[model samples]
Target chain A: MSAAAAKAKRAVRRPVSIASFAQSENVRRDDQHNEVEMLMPVVAEVFANIGITKNDIDFICSGSSDYLIGGPFSFVTALDAVGVWPPMPESHTEMDGAWALYEAWVLLQEGEIDAALVYSFGRSSPGNLNEILALQLDPYYLAPLWPDPVSVAALQARALIDAGKGSEEDFAAIASRSRKDALSNPKAQVAHDIPVETLLRDEYVVSPLRRHTLPPITDGAAAMVLAAGDKAREWSDKPVWITGFDHRIETHSLGGRDLTSSPSTAKAADVAGVADGPIDVAELHAPFAHQEIILKEALGLDDGVTINPSGGALAANPIMSAGLIRIGEAAARIASGQAARAVAHATSGPCLQQNLVCVLEGE
Target chain B: MSGQTTAEDLGPVTTLATPIRLDFEFTPGVAQSRFLRGLEKGRFVGQRCPTCGKVYVPSRGSCPTDGVPTTEDVDLANVGTVTTYCVVNVPFAGQSIEIPYICAQVLLDGADISFMGLIQQIPTDEIRMGLRVEAVWVEPEELTPSLASVRYFRPSGEPDADYETYKDYL
Candidate 1:
């Protein structure tokens, strides 16, 4: 293991495991419900899966963005779905749900809370997501130019091609494999069994990125229950322990960073001890097809490893919740005895500027 | 060597102004849709939480206290008590009302929550907590599925309500 990985392992405090996971059906639009309505069922199911109730949880954290709904404090209203009566201790982050899970994990390490709930929701159908996402860039430089997500990802794809790291056919192959694998995931929004050659023939949304390379604009919510130590063991017969967790971020100035590679993901993987053991499955949150290739290289996974068994983000990318869903998907496999060890990865910002890596094992 | 930049050596730092416009179609969930439909019929409708029995105006579909849907609809009186208020004196980009107007939280009778509304027909100095007010409706032709149907709230000329009546709302 790397020196950094050894140091991270030494910092471990309490063992935390995922007790349960649940998600709403990813769809192009959920006109029938608002953010609160969308999360109600998901929160219920996550708790129910563990045969527990909200009364048993010690803390609640959620992730969401008000920009998606064009309102301030959107999460405050979403909290109603959890019925936080008696005023439960709660927190929120304007980031992907994976960060919220990280916060819960930190709290669990303190040994004060035995269990916590983490959730996130996003409704991209309410507004034009491309324009909304551009606002997340540096307001003075990138936002003024309105560089949408697609164009930014295309730049990364072009960089990969220019650096001889990957080719257009490789991008198509990633997309084809992901969507085809999603056929088994009932909650997935996009699933198909098409050939890679057929996808390559599609018109390009941006140069170096075809329409199939981009993720669908989906509205969805996801929730998970996390318990530490003995509580975790009591909750599930086969607990998926979070052995290692770490995250890193890069500068927002896209031009200053290398676009063809993901240094942040590699650093996080090292700190998370991703290479310490043999990985049976990996669920990478790569919204763009080319991004999956970059992440695979950064994580240093071998051909023998199974990737995106739940189709990954290329199948159902629901903005804020997609990253956390990766962790849940990986943990579910471990809990079901489908895999002994897994690596779940989540990325945020443009060109994978921010990344979180989690290592899980069945016990 | 001393490191410093003289005024003459420094050039002007360029800056640019940009406007961001994002359009959205907000779907008010089941409770809010029902409330809007009630407004079209000149009624104040709210939903009562089954667990807590708290009536939320502009029903938010779920009771935040219990984490359950508020299924029981309750019609509230247009008359309410002003729990608190503020006088807006500054102008903003989208200021529709004139400055120095009273914007108050009105706790409609039978509703557990208070909603923000404009206070009119009373002198600014006369607007106070616990003051009774009634809704002022626009012409029926202008009525739509919006809270705008009620133009504002005016003093009802009744005696101020007891503090106990709106203390919880504040």
Candidate 2:
């Protein structure tokens, strides 16, 4: 083992804060702009809102998948949108933007860099999103079958019903409420005030998974600035403090695991201290409506929690960026004083195989 | 034992070849659209960064160093200098150009960045840094919104540029 590995554990207590956040308007197809173009305005807005330049940032990390664009080295090309002239420390995650934020958070805990920029973008309109997502499955068994995300999610929904954990009505209700809440959010692509009955009447895209239950195919980008210690206070008067952050992943084998409950989410919640305080709001990255029920239960959130006030992923799911947007949305609420404490969740892999939970609070 | 195994001897095959092919409709975005349109008109257009005043050909909409958009459009001359080059002596699949062809980073005058262009009409050994060159465009009738509109670059016969002129670009 290296000398650094042999050292005593370093408890990172340096408070990190979500200083600023911004997101592009979600659309069905952003034909006018490429991923970099879609991301430029959002990155600019994120930094502009905080009255700082790229020079103020010490580290930059982003999350995106090349599969969406059917190209490689896209993240490297994406740096053009950020203007890495002097060349700064940068990193990327092929998972979700939330994971990028986790990386930046870990970097900050080391107490070296004062701030970091986290951004992500996805254009689901370019390719067959369903077919593209199936590539994420295990190559040996699950992937050869070519089960799309909707079909996989349907299996989870069916499992939920089989276990008596949730009903199809519960899925409709979540979809209805999420879209209704999205009506006020201009960034949401699918927003409406539809009743549960009306939503249920909609035809099922897959068994037990209606068109309303599945997240809208969206092209969008989001950015957030994280600052530590004095920089956080200097940047925002109402800095949203990230009290606890943790992520966990379950087994990749779909047949081997229980689909009804998200044990990974429950574990992440415990590690993130989700039950330590009352959650005034939550932004869960449940691409399918029924999965929201699983997440709410896993996080141990009751009826009092205002879920997905920004319409959640149901309104606009921009693949790689959707998960980070949850964290940003949750922080925005706390920063605005709309909520004192908030829980943000991001999920990846088929049927929530991986999960991340972040607890945000305001002073 | 035989060199090849039978199905019974092979047991369950552990490997699978599942070829996944996905098509995409690429959108080049606003800045590249401008550059492509410029090519359609037989002009080399670039965008200048507002902060640094460095012009980028085929700007992807932002100044990479400053993380800001290059908004100002500047029409550039067809003439430039070869900042760097390599001879493709080895043949490979999807190889369109002949072997020993010169592929070079052409730094257009008044532009801050260099873009790859095929350097031809000269011997491979003759290609060198700071070599002056000029774009040879496609026939006007065949012009389209593509880099192909500028077919290639050839020796401009102008005096070699000072090494300092394009060292930053290199």
Candidate 3:
């Protein structure tokens, strides 16, 4: 390759490290704290971990949904938690915090800023999340039918079973293992050691998905600080370097595409270089149990890879923040010496229509 | 030969209204709950920020500038100045009050921020900046943990506050 071509490629692969991460304790209903109150301590802890303040941060980006709060410009009120006075360069995404982090990573790659703070918060308990999520469907056709998230997910689960991709037993097994792993996670909302056999005995909330397979309705928030190069080293001795970061999206028309497979995830994984090296741990944002199976196959994760050490989203899915939490959990594993290399996956839209993959490594 | 339609053939169908309502159980959180409770007792309470020492009425849990919990509570006087206001000449839906009513941002004594309140018992033309006003509470029996306990604000009959006092709030 020409030297100029090599330089251009190197610029695209600039390293950004997750310097710090903190999340509110996942809870079924956080009646005592609003979104701003929930995020205050988490943001404080994230900055304090790196011995920095909001002043040290060059940019701020947050992810949240207006539908969750039943009001528009909810994120503007949320910025109060960050003390963004005197004005700062900021942006927001209506999607998950993982995508907010992606925007920050892109800015850091351009070498415009040294650090950025990314956060997301959601309270699914306040509203009928099933009906709220239905609003995201095609307004003309699907939204009028008001297919709740569980029923839609059940459709995907049934497709997986009929296509011979997996079974109800497989879904239960994923739920069983994820929740069992969550027992050790202090931030997890639902952590149990229930056996898959017992889970299978329970009646399905929707066909192919029992109550155990569904994620807990959680109200929580998460915050992370990303720094590049010298600032990253200053923040931590073992900075989890984001070697590859990429996201992809599939068509929003659910029936037009296959539900049994996650083509978007596969494409994101390829671009993110998930298979370039041995992945010791993989954190996936799979709110539904069977979705984990599909994501695993899409990402091409093998038997040697450990999945959802933080119990994944089955233990606690706080909508906009859960996907970002997956990235933080994966980075934490690398920072703690539990793994040298890790891959984090976040999905959005119905049936994994959007996917973001980030490859992290520690030296 | 062709499937074509002229504008004259099609009637105007420019708008489609899809009204949506999603109910939510709002939890006011620790800070707002205290402020709401104070309203029930016919009192104005504000929280003092530990970092900046700025008082926020009905504290939405933290100081917007400091991002820290305003733990210190301060009892505030009802009487304050109208830093700024708008005369609602045009009627809007769900507007119970008569047209040309005054809606003003009232900055209570010792509070750093201003809160919106309906200015009553005064001409819309006379609702100037720095006009002194006091909250009019609902009947004692109607008191509850809500801002609704305070019916509205009217001219306090006190002297207008100096512009220098609340210029920062404006």
Candidate 4:
């Protein structure tokens, strides 16, 4: 390749830093407040952490799902929490808040906006989440059958076992370690330090996967502030720079792809430069215990990397906000001088069909 | 391309209908809980946003403009001005109201936001913007923690409100 063309392809974009992060206490049911009330404190805390106000933000973006709330235009009402008076530029995504963060990152890369606010909220307790999640499947072929999320994850677990890649004991170990780590996380909804042997003794919710392997249904919200270049330096003393970020998705048809492996995650890891340096900490948004094993393999993390230091989605999976919380958890560690470099991962769709990987560093 | 067949050559089209039924129970939040309880007491309770000073009926919990919780409770009069309205002539399944009824956006006195209310005890053609109306409550014995406590609204026999009074609500 010509030097000019190669240089053009290798061009690096402006860096965006995660200046601040905050999240609501993950719980089974927050009966006292609605979506707006749930997000108000989180949004306020995120801005307060950075010593900034809504007027300082150039753009606002949020992530949420209307299906979880049983209403259309749900995010429109959520905008009330951001105090959008004076008419600010804003956008929203129906997917996870991590994708909303990605949108804000892309806008910052344009070098126009100095700072942006990203937030997301979900309340999964008011409805039958298993039945609601089934709606995300193919309406004609899969949804009509009403296969709940646990059963789908069970199928993936069974596939992994059949492929001789892992066992049920491995799944229990992941659960044990995650919940134990969650003991320090005051925001986590489920936290316990039960032994793997005790977890294995429990009855299976579905064949080859026990109740310990599944994630808890949670109601929560999270917010983060992203500032570019000098603005980042002004906000945070230890800014967690987003050095590389990318996301990829595989085919929607579950039967068409290998359930035992995650190709999309591996591809995203490559694009996000996961192996560029030693990873001190990693927060993987794997809702199920076994999926963490699959993601570890996809991201090529070795035994030295500390995984799910905040207990991860298995401890508090709040649907739309869980993925964003993973990004926040990883950045918080780096910002606190606990880690120099980290990797945060988020997944969407059934069986980890879609994935996003972000590499963060404190410089 | 020669293997392609026309629609007429195909025998028939097949389609499947799957009916999905989901049940959910929602708990009214802090602001809504108070609003509903006030309705049970035959009172019209509204909350005012501290930042914008806009009063909202039935308390939206938060102000859409300022994104702050409406803190101060404002007790509004039963009478209101019709900012805009629609005559529902067509019927649908499970509709409680009869045909050709006037459903209007009622801007309550001392409140900035408008709420949907049923206009009754007057001809549909007479229900226009700036028409003053008052709530017609069900008997005290039938009162409940719901908007249904007010059967409907009727002409208050007072002078019509000037259009300028509620034009902003429209």
Candidate 5:
């Protein structure tokens, strides 16, 4: 062993693949129902599809933010959908639902549990997400300016523009492409095939980023079931196995890192083996139109790969659930035997500071 | 008339939630135990990795690079340099300062690691990268086992330095 190896303990590693996944329609805004009511159907559907109950779940994990709910420990009330009267083993991460999947994957790596249920929910329409995200900034210094999410994203857009990497027209092209592809997706909320020139005529929410480039404010939820080894075989005729998974976080301060490039996404792509082979479909959770381009380059996807046939975050960004929805969409493709392999990505924090990437496959 | 500030008018009104300070005495792990204990003793200590010979200020017992517990304790000065910083235009929950203040990354002398702190004894508008700074240690009798023991960083009367000095620091 090398000198450092003598000091470091041997780390345990194993493989845990996804078995099932489900999500609700990407709504523009679920005004009639609250978050709990909106999330229940999605969870119930997953349980019914798998022939399982709350008690059958060995572990339960979820992801969300208190800021979105405008209350502390907002996730506490979410347990109602979970029916925690018996108090099943549970934990929560204040991140995207994909990270919750990562935590469940870790638990499964312990080699004790056979199945886990992961979920996430958010209602962005209740409060302005752009203004709410201002809280993530440094307390004493930058946060008081109330630098909303769109403005931060706009700043990054301008930086990319100044760097000569791309332009506003390019952003419009991404939106037009997404909406055209989403036209076939029954669950897509804001799917349309408006000409790129028509989209360019739209007014800017923050300069360089038009309303079309941003995701629709939405309220939704999602759930995914994970099983490994023999348990995976019992789930379906075609089980989409999680072959690789990894994520990375950059500095919280936007000024500290290069806004034009996503090193975190690039690093996570490398760790998750996104470039290993032919990825039939790649679902990216880029909330902004230009971000899709940055993430595409960062992930190193070629023209042959499919990008978000399911409208993606731009169509209906439900705060916390939007990223997780990408995973669900990617897995749905493989579970239905449409694609043999797929890649899904999720992002959180301002300007996509943290990202999670997972590769799904069918045997 | 619907005279009340009810749910419909506000479009999903929330119960007012304010900045809450969630204070927990997170006991420093074995790797950070001595380093914290030293702070309680009012002594600035650093840990030296026997192999890499790099020292960490706000000393950690484990060399982050070596991943091994550090054996030797190296005492350090209370002085450091203001690496890079931003003007705080907003206030946040659990913050002890008012608006228009400066939060800087301080690279302590003889230490490879950097830590965050409030910059005082200088105008927020005048704060710049690479500003020399020194810690204003709290009264020995009033010191607690928390990072708040060091009041803030104050100007050390050094000339303004270039960005390259701390450009890569961020």
Candidate 6:
């Protein structure tokens, strides 16, 4: 690569570290409270715990899909948290919270900003979530047919079954494991081990995918604080440094491409170098039970690696925020000396259509 | 998590009934407009990348890798093998098809990539992957000057393709 090309690439991939992180409890559906009110305590605690004020931040970015709120430009209403009176440089992507964090990391790498804030919110209880998610497909061909998320995932699950890689028993085990893990997480909405055998007895939502195979319709918000190398050291004694981050999107139509596996996520993981490095923990954003198995194979994680200490999305899953919180939770482990390195994965669209993978290390 | 307002404050539930007709007189932007205009006459089309010799179905406005336009007009074959598919059991608003229908990605002959369409003229349970399907054309009067002019795909009377051939696609 020429110096100019190398410089441009470096400009896009600077090592930013997580300085602070916080989140609200994921609920079945927060109908009583609005997004802003639900977010204030999370935002305030994250900043206050780090001993920083609004003035200390240089940039803010968010990830959200307007389709969640049944309205467009939903991020505009979130400006109240930043007190935009003294405005700020900000942008948003129609992705999950993890991608928003990626955008902030890119902006920080530009050398213009030392600190940034990333946040996301999603409320799925207001609508029929399974049906609402079908809109994520290609509007021209796939979306008009309205194949829900679970059915698409079931196709993948069936493929896994056909390929002899997984089965309904294995999927039930993942659900049982997640609910058991959620018992320790205060913010987890679905937190109980119902026993895999009992779960397997439940009726299918879309054949091969039982009701327990899906996460509840959750509404919640999450935020993470990022700072450049020097700023990171100043903010905390231990910082979780982002070493590699990459995201890739595939064609939106379901039938136009593969379904048994997630090539987009696998390619993204390869680009992000998740397979090359040593990972002690992984936080994968697999809302459906079966997706967790697919992402595990895509990222090439071993049995040695700890997965979803935050109980995974099957426990909480607040749509847009769930992905970003995965990054935040993974980074927190590294920052707190719980893990030396970790990989965080996020997915959007039907059956993991678009995916982002981020690698972080402790310094 | 910050600055996101509550449900009541989010605003009134204004259901937009806007008919989002994103009809573009797309000048192919870079590829062959001739192939696109052929849709007006209900023709399946593609364009070949001269340098790579790759025939892109719904021919690339630009090559996937080089980002260069494919200019030649290549009217495509109506029949192909299904690479993969999903039963769209759930229905959406403004949907033209019924539920429990099979939607498959058909790799039309001589094309580099597959295109999606409804698998018709067969039982839903019988819509297996790699099933040979021929394009069912719309009536001349119903031709819309778009991809939708092809009513759907039906069994092509060819042998069901062995799954191993398209396993990579799955």
Model 4's TM-score against the true structure: 0.95
lDDT of 6 at A252: 68
Candidate 4 lDDT, A1-363, residue by residue in tens: 675664444234988999989999899988888888889889889988878889899999999998887877989988988888889989999989999999999999898898999999998987899999998888888999999999999999999999998999999999999999999999988999999999999999999889999999899999999999788989978778998898999988898999989999998887787887899999999999999989999999999999999999989999899999999999989988999999999999999999999999998
Candidate 3 vs candidate 4, lDDT winner: 3
Model 6 DockQ vs. reference: 0.01
Give the higher-TM-score candidate: 3 or 6. Answer: 3
What's the fnat for candidate 2, on a 0 to 1 scale?
A: 0.90
Clashing pairs in 2: A82-B67, A83-B64, A83-B67, A84-B64, A85-B65
lDDT of 5 at A186: 74
lDDT of each: 0.92, 0.92, 0.91, 0.90, 0.78, 0.78
Model 1, DockQ value? 0.67
lDDT of 1 at A137: 92
Candidates 3 and 6 compared: the better one by DockQ is 3
Residue range A15-113, candidate 5, lDDT tens digits: 565666778876765655445545667877887887877666789899998776566676865665656645678889998898999999989888888
Interface RMSD of each: 1.0, 1.0, 1.3, 1.4, 19.8, 20.0
Q: Best by DockQ, which number?
A: 2
Chain B TM-score against the true chain B, candidate 1: 0.88
Candidate 4 pairs with clashing backbones? none
Model 1 per-residue lDDT at B38: 86
Per-residue accuracy of model 2 over B40-150 as CA lDDT, tens digit each: 999899999898898999899988888788889999999999999999999999998889899999999888889999999999998999999999999999899999898
TM-score of each: 0.93, 0.94, 0.95, 0.95, 0.66, 0.66
Better-scoring candidate (DockQ), 1 or 5: 1
Looking at model 1 chain A, report the run of 10 residues with the lowest lDDT sum. Answer: A3-12
DockQ, each predicted model: 0.67, 0.75, 0.65, 0.56, 0.01, 0.01
Worst window of 10 by summed lDDT in candidate 2 chain B: B1-10
Lowest-sum lDDT 10-residue window in model 3 chain A: A3-12
lDDT of 5 by residue, B15-53 (tens): 544453322222233335556666777756777877578
